[model samples]
Target chain A: MNRRAFLATTAAGAAVAAFPAILKAQGGDTIKVGFPGPTTGPFGALAKDQQQGASVAMEEINAKGGILGRRLEILFRDDQLKPAVGAQRTKELIENERCEFIVGGLAAHVQMAINEQTKKAGKLFISVSQSDEITARPDWGPLTFHEALNPTITSRAVGNWLAQNLGKKWWILYADYAWGKQNNAVLTEVLKRQGGVLLGSTPYPLGNPEFSAHLPKILAAKPEVLVTMTPGADNIAFLKQAISFGMKKEMKIAQPLHWLPQLKEGGPDLYADIYAGINFSWQLEDAIPEAKNYVALYRKKHNEPPGDYSAYAYSAIHEVARGITLAKVVNSDAVASALIANPVYNHYKGKQWWRACDHKAFQDLWIVKGRERSKMKGEWDFVDIVQKVAASEELDRSCKEKGFV
Target chain B: MAELTLATLAAQAFTGLVLGMILVLLAIGLSLIFGLMTVVNFAHGSLYMLGAYLGFFLIGYTKSFWLALVVAPLLVGALGFGIERFLVRPLYGRSIDDPLLLTFGLSLVMVETVRLIWGKIGLTLDPPRELAGAVNLGFTYFPLYRLFVIGVTVVVLVALFVFLEKTNVGLIIRAGSRDPLMVKALGFDLGRVWLLVFGIGTALAGLAGILAGPMRGVYAEMGVTIIIESFVVVVVGGMGSLVGAIVAGIAIGEVVSLTTLFAPKFAEIMVFIVMALVLLVRPSGLFGESGLME
Candidate 1:
């Protein structure tokens, strides 16, 4: 062989020999967490808030010498609010990006798809979206942890409050989807248990813009309260139209969740007199030290108050990091065991514990009434916290109902 | 269920009519562009969303919904003119798929642009103070803005009808759409006419957007849902026929509205069902002329 050819072959052999070490060094530098969210569609704002919250958690973790003596990193992928897209992105995150843990699913149905992929890969999936089914039957696994409040908890809290305050006759209007249906069923059950009269129920398509058509039926029923479960833009449209039709004069309006970003968009005037259940309110800073810290940190970064959904992502990231720290390893099984064993966390609010039976986080839920414009103290102060529903195992379905018994 | 009284029926009917008018406003723009240019402008919805955004900003600046109403459509029309001139005109002679794909991509780009400019957060636009409240119609209290929308739609429809029927420019546009080469040979600037028609079509979409902004808050993906429905309206109405668009738009609207009362689960699909039934009966649509499919 020629001299030059001999040198080239030697160089190629050395490069191949060094490649695995290089890959190991690169991989070991930081722990990657996969976050697939609906960052582009209707849920874009919420997804952005989640990303910001995750960033803050990442920063804090890295500053304290990240999990297992390695820096922590988050990889965000846009799911475009589609379940198929979410699943695909999650697969890419696990298989290609080599993310050992998964976080994020802004929409209810989309989160289930993400969970399925994470389950197949045997990676811990900390879902940040709400859905009763996420923790119940067929979907939950050893590695599945839900940080957001499920519909059952939200509905029961708000339902008990509405029953005691608002009159018995209630009409329901919900976006025809999994999340909406779940809230409707749970709320209906709670209300019926309290001897509430069911006026009627209307299920409109998701993302529906027109609610005027349903006004006649609602008017005819003359319900004392109108409970709507339309999420996001649909909720705003429904309320605006409902108010315009003078339905507010006849019946009070309430919902399972009051999204902070939405409250900002819809304004105080539109949301005034409406009641909703929420996970966190910025005003909690007055009483909760963690909330104050979180709101301050988030405001410093984003120049806005942290949304309720933001707390979910923030807590999920922190808890996952804590699990890694406790396990003293990057392995999924070790982290899962650590989290499941410990089972208690308080990232940005009151104490929340993970139910060993279902892996659902039991946290305090609040019922808030929208404050009128005259009573508002600031732009973000849209709702007044009226009642707190203490977190408990009873707020969730029994283990048997979860098919765990 | 409550008794379906005459009062209830009247309320439901008015609701249906309002929805129909909004659909009419949107679908007319889609119909006009297709009728005149045979360009399936998928970007029409983006243009509508643009109008809403522009109106939102204009209202912030000018503090006048009325001024935004007049100006936003014109701004959108100007944009349509540019889109037709620079982007669409070059693809005119290619496979019809060329323009369809281009416009589809344009829609995606436009949505992203809006997001970049306005951020992903949704924003609301309030109706003018005068039209903010409900009006008692005895049957039910209806939104004054909605009633205003109906009135504006009727006036706009009447004006459009007169323009299309009686004007020389409208005649030239009609002739050029049928036989572009013949019209070009007859010494008329067919390119300008096509551009104008595209502009007018998109401006109608813009008008619909601003009108809808108050009812439905302005957001990045606001157009994505309505665009599909507008296409359904156009197809069910007959691809390029104005009268067909009007009739199908209203019929589909009423179907959706009434279905909410009787069978809420089917409200979304009722439009598609109507479209299928119409196609099964008259493939060309209610008022469509023959041979466009060829």
Candidate 2:
């Protein structure tokens, strides 16, 4: 063949190969959000709720003609609640699926994994998981944003509230894990600041069926209040066994995630009068009309009141959508810049904003007590909000001092 | 700590008995399988989980608890029989460790299969209407379903004891456990006896799972935790001794319950501690016979 013909053929093939990329860069009609969370594991229930909430929010956004008239499409991948899986999935979502933004993190470890990966990729990562001080700290990556309440903030708030309302003496029984340990440390510091004495503290292995060994030590200490950071079946089992052992009669129980419905599944009698800190509750109608509307809409659609994870996931999707609108572009860098620059958007909880220093979003935390079944109107009814603690009052400045932001 | 009160102690004791009863049901199948086959079926816990999921699905479909109670075990037993006939039968003359390793691998495969089929969300099965609520025992309120479990376990143990002691097939099986060569020499089909023993053993594990489904959430990894404790029970009970399994199972259960009353954190580790102590005191186990297999 002639040299001219050969050159022309080669040029045509190269142009065909690069055409798709050029079209993609010009801006597609669809805005894709990547979600990686524990869809199957011990926290699988929470993952399911998160998926539902995100889907609902996406539907709402699409119904309103989506962001900048582009349909919002969420491509969710299961991280399996492992840090390694989280990192791998984040890489795949960004490099392969070409997702414009990323959302959802069920566990703190997974969140940290995604944070590192998204930072490297220079993409926005809005975390739904609780890891106390990632967002408001200057040391944190610029691309990260958090929608959930910080563990340190929530724990300190609960501890201070307990010291003031319940008693001065406190005992801590936490799961022997990173989140549990950190939460206990923060609570201890906050309680001491509030003029409360830390009588004793014990860490139990995750998924240990019997808490009998720790119960005796706790009973011996006989502190006025007991704070537990247990979640899932572990929390349910602890509460049931605690009631049977008569620990409830001696000391008031405070769980950070106690308002979760899993506690009620152990039986209403066991969880009765137990205090827990939550970001939002279906019973918080008097606090925020949007929360009330959220509960009604959630129930109307799912036949149940929205849990913490669900509400967070729903709010995250809406927040991301708003950011996309503000940026007027689906590119990751543009949307991220808009999210960082914008003030707190009114979420389901209330007016909330991401702290630029650490990227943590500060919001109201509610203290709820489990009520007796006789007082409850239905199966899902268990907790009643006792107090609505404001974000500004509850947030600790130590996060800044500790260089968490 | 303050002086322990009698009322509290009594309540703990009652709780212990209830806990022990569940352990007894879980350990019986493992004990029986070990005795007859000289094979420590590590997949026993997987069988239990299968039973629970099967019962959950069956009960949901039929809306008849009785039907599920009967059918779930039978299905699990059949699966166990298949495993024994195809996988286990070939490795019979190999080192004892071979079966243990084989069963462990089988357990992982079974657990993963269940996860793929059912998803990882833990499922809760409701107790039947008659046994749903708690009963106040004057001093304390006890879950009625738990009490029912104790009663059912007692009945099963009694029936199992009678069958092992009185029935012809049970006698043949027991004799085979002592000398499989002698049984084969006598012109009896030893393979059939082995299969039956394996089937029955796996079915008992399934029965335990079905009973426990309502008490605890059924999930893919549900068997992982229970199997470890069950192994401790088997070792403490003296390997393959049925009576020893019962006694040790109940003892371990009580220890767990009472320990929770005093120290909730150490309750889990206490089982292993007791096993270590039992091994130190009686190397062959409480009822285990020395040099019985080798």
Please tell me which predicted candidate would have the highest DockQ against the true structure.
Answer: 1
Q: What global local distance difference test value does model 2 have?
A: 0.80
Write down the lDDT of every candidate, Cα atoms only. 0.89, 0.80
**Candidate 1 chain B least-lDDT 10 residues:** B285-294
Worst 10 residues of 2 chain B by lDDT: B1-10
Sequence-dependent TM-score of model 1? 0.88
Regions of model 1 farther than 4 Å from truth: A1-36, A58-102, A117-122, A321-335, A338-341, B85-102, B170-192, B235-241
Query: Ten residues in a row with the worst lDDT in model 2 chain A?
Result: A208-217
lDDT of 2 at A357: 63
- Which docking band does candidate 2 fall into? incorrect
Local accuracy of candidate 2 as per-residue lDDT tens digits, A1-405: 899999999999999999999878754677888999998778877887788888878887898898897888898999999999999999999998888689988878788888888989898888997885455443267778888877777887887788999998988888888888989988888888898888878777787644543554566567999999886777765765566456787789998766354654555776789998888777776568888867777777788777778888888889889888898877667777787799578768788877666666778888888888799878777788888888772375555474753
lDDT, candidate 1, A263-312, per-residue tens: 88888989999999999999999999999989998999889899999899
lDDT of 1 by residue, B2-41 (tens): 7778888878888998888888988999899888778999
